[model samples]
Target: MGLRTIGGWLQEQHVQLHMGRWLLELDDARAEREFTSYDDVRGLAEGRFALYIGIALTLAYGVVDVLVLDELQLDVSLVRLAVVLLFACAVVVTGRAIWVGRHLQVSSVVLLTVVLLMLGTTLGRAADFPTEYLTTSCTVTLFGAIGLLRLRMHAVLVMAGVYSAVCLSLPGALQGVDALARNVAPTLGLAAIAVVIGFSLEKLRRTDYLRQREVEAEQARSDELLHNVLPAPIARRLRTEPGAIADSAPEVSVLFSDIVGFTPVSEALAPEELVQLLDTMFREFDELCEARGIEKIKTVGDAYMAVAGLPEPDPDHAASLAELALDMQRTLARLSPAWPSPIAMRIGIASGPVVAGVIGRRRFTYDLWGDTVNTASRMESHGRPHRIQVSAATHALLESRYTFSDPQVVDVKGKGPMTTYFLLGSNL
Candidate 1:
């Protein structure tokens, strides 16, 4: 196989501990893709400025060529103008759809070497001054390699090899043995300096990239936890304001469900069993809530609370909550065989304007206040096992769409006798 193909394949692999240092890389494909994405964006601004500076220097050198008395000045000017215009076009078109990256760095080094070789061929040949410009050419190539281009080791090596090969061969072809020997030491010394600077800069850049990835991952985890603690809308408001968020939802339905006879059942079972039971049942309730367009409010002990139409307004908030409550009953019936005791639930729903917001500085909770919340809780406490009791307001909203038993008057605490109904099933 060709040496260039082998070298290309080697550069694509992540090589660690290469001649002692400077080969910082990731072995995993996912991490490599992530780093490539980061490197592409990071190199864009740096490479663009470097490109601008290179273009300016090329134009200035073309002017200097005209000032010098040489027969090849016209040839040199045309070459310089062509190189400058090519890079100038890169300046205009870059950062639009196309971009600059490691390849840009490699191209810059190769093109700079090409310009020097072209100049040396046209002017340095046949001049009485032997190998005087070779040292300066090596230095200029190193400047673009380390300072202007900031190339990685592989690309820097390519630049060094091309220049060294030219210095070794052409001095004999153009000058003599003495000229080849004179340029050798300077070429190698400058190449060493370029590679060293490139290594250190790249090592530091890789370190920073890893650190940034870690910080972003941490922020994502923290955001996920925060979103779980509160509703997305409430959490966003809390982040922007970082204060007490008190929002009055004009019309929302609240559902409070409690496991019937769970207190005595908890006494009979082991702590682990009790917790498993609650987790299994509540997890199912959570799924039902999500499926039925309900936002889960915090659960207290064996009780599960949910709301609809608060964070985002749902026009049929009461009807949606009604559907969720019935789903909870059906879910419990399906799960009854595995339970330690015969499982039943009492769910109460109410619809009205309520004050809802995040409360407490530590262990923040999204809670509800006002008569509607109290009425819902009271309806659940007064409710019968295996039945869904709802307030008059909720019944008013769902009456057209649902089947309810006869309205009955019940004495509820914190309020006088109130009219309530039992949600049986859907009309169809």
Candidate 2:
């Protein structure tokens, strides 16, 4: 094999690896959407690239030696050639192990052993005499063993150990040391150098793996947190769209529920206990919202806010909001006993156009802004406990499907006196 042939083979391998990576990206996209288990596919693709690159580089060196060093010749005969060929076959077999999706440990061991044997045989053939051969073999074996250890391949370590011992004992077997001392010393030194290099490489590899794992774990935690705070559809949209902010979302129904006399009740309990109680109540509220297919906007102190439009809107936003408020009132009534301090709830339902989205660069929250959210909050604040209040806008939308008490004119903080109605119950 000449340099040109080796370079061509390497270039071909690079092209193949690049093509495989490109195809793998397409496969990855499809797998992400359709397959539940994608790690296996990803692992196989990565392993294939690693093996392809490793073999190409290793063979390129061999090709360089064969082509550039014309004077260099191995004393080994047909048997040695057959052994080398067998070792090469082993490399290919081990490389294919990734496709089987089996134990990487077993495959690594087999491959490491073959590589060691090949290196040992090549070095042995280059030695001038038995003593020299022993020295050179020991040096190569020791260093190669260290490299294998760095690679974290147990099988390679075993091969290195055996090879090192053979090299050290070669002089004794040949019954000549004085003549081979010069070559032996140099071989031992080279082996020691290889061990140092292997140590450094292994440390770097471990550090890289640790960093990669940390990044992946952090990303998973962030994803989990995002899903916890936002509805699936909204979260997905926010992720796909950069710098997402809610524009003028049209005719979305908003629901606001606040615990009546929650301030006094919260004062009665410890801060931690108050938070715990709130968390329990809110978690339940979240489940109810999800069950009713409502997108939660945000929570303020003791109040729960939610919406039913934008980021995949539903036409029956008013009806859904009405139904959800009724369910929540009923559910909270049953859960009153679980709270450290007994409390009742006042829920307000309203339908109107409003802008809702994540705001703030730091400590951000998905919230609704505009008069609609404030008016809905005021309705809850002024509402009687155990009742659901509805703005005229919301009442009009649900008037056909839900029964409501006659319009009650109420004074609100920001929006003066407004006509609101009590949602009696669902007509359905």
Candidate 3:
């Protein structure tokens, strides 16, 4: 996007950026609150390094004084050495002390210090210092220190003012207006350019920070939605390793249930009313299933299906599924909807080995496929309303802990002639 477009967006309601003294700052209170921590991290990262770099460059330049000058000027050499020693002490204090919390403040002081030493060095050799010396000193100071550190607009302007003072004083020290008239333009010109670069860099960093945080917040919301749709463990697996999630659960229990007399009642109510009734009824079932540690498979028309075990195993799968079935009947009985009368449910549970996995590519779901699932459905269809029925396997596991009707031989759909029993209630 163009600069104009980005600037316009910076003023938008979501994250309003305003011009502060010389730099862009958050105008919106909420944006300022959010940006504070991000800006602190940037200061900490940049401040620690900028101090080290300034000290190294200052030390290197002192070596240049000893080698490059025609004669070793003791006063100029001593000045450079003092600046290096001072910078080293600042690094240790800011780098390791508890007051490193004041990184941004330390950084501003470091930049001003560079400008001060450069001025002092020029004044120390007033007669030998040619007008051209300001050009080299100003160039070195701007390029080495300011460019290495990321300073905001106001800080950049402060350095510009300090440099202008040193340049303006040169003409009087040399005792001539010709000195000011000749060299003033170029030195001031560099300071102006530094301001523009500094402002742009600060704006760019803030923009990148805002976008990165947006992406992280969006990812968190999506992961939460995915967890709600699938089991927590299954959702986590799919996120880390995406593919067909399959597992063979040898010991599990499955439950199938349907709203008895649903058709006649649904036909009697308006379409909107019918939908509202279903939503209300199922929401209750969903909450109850969660409380009983049951994983709801899906609801087909008025039929509700769920299972206990597989995704995560429970040795007491049969008992858990059985308790969920009993609660479904009680929950349905208590639900008062726009229907003609009270609702009742027929639930069936079967226990044995089953193959469980997530199905579908875009619109995915977690489900089970095996004889246990089929037997549970058959038990619900063949069993009576307002009652929970179970296969012989499930009944064997629960008869000791739960109350049940006398066993009866019934003709099953896929498998002929199977013995099943009706669940009455819990023993204790």
- Model 2 per-residue lDDT tens digits across residues 1-428: 22222223233332111124111211233222221133334433454445554455444444544444454455433323544465456546645655444444344445545554544544455543445543443454345434442333233344445455455444343346753565455545554555456545544543444344445555666766887777666677777888766768878888889888887887788999888878887888888878877888788898888988755688998888888888887778787887766688899877888887777777667778777778888888889988899899988898988898988899988788999999999888
**Cα-lDDT of candidate 1:** 0.73
lDDT of 1 by residue, 1-428 (tens): 22222122234443222343444455554565556556656565566786687678777766655455444455566766776776676666556635345456555665656755654554455332235554464356456646555565666667667666655444443356665456667667766776777777777766676565555555665776898888888888988996589989989999999988888889998999888978998899888877876899988998988999978899999989999998899999998888877978999999999998888989989988888889999989999999999999999998998999999999998798999999999996
Question: Model 1 TM-score?
Answer: 0.86
lDDT by residue (1-428, candidate 3, tens digit) is 32212233344556655686666887666566456555655665666577677677767766655555666677776666666676677667656775554455446645465655454445335335554654556556665555555556666777777666666566343455766556677768877877787777778877786676556555655776887789889999998886788999988999999888888888888899889989988899899878877888899999989888868888999999888888777777677544687667888899999997888888898888999999999999998989899999999999999999999999998799999999999998
Clashing pairs in 1: none
Task: Give the lowest summed-lDDT range of ten residues in model 3.
Answer: 1-10
Q: Judged by lDDT against the true structure, how good is candidate 3?
A: 0.74
TM-score of each: 0.86, 0.64, 0.77
Which candidate, 2 or 3, would have the higher TM-score against the true structure?
Answer: 3
RMSD of candidate 2 to the truth, in angstroms, is 12.2
Better of 1 and 2 by TM-score: 1
Clashing pairs in 2: none
Model 1 RMSD vs true structure = 6.3
Model 2 lDDT-worst window of ten? 17-26
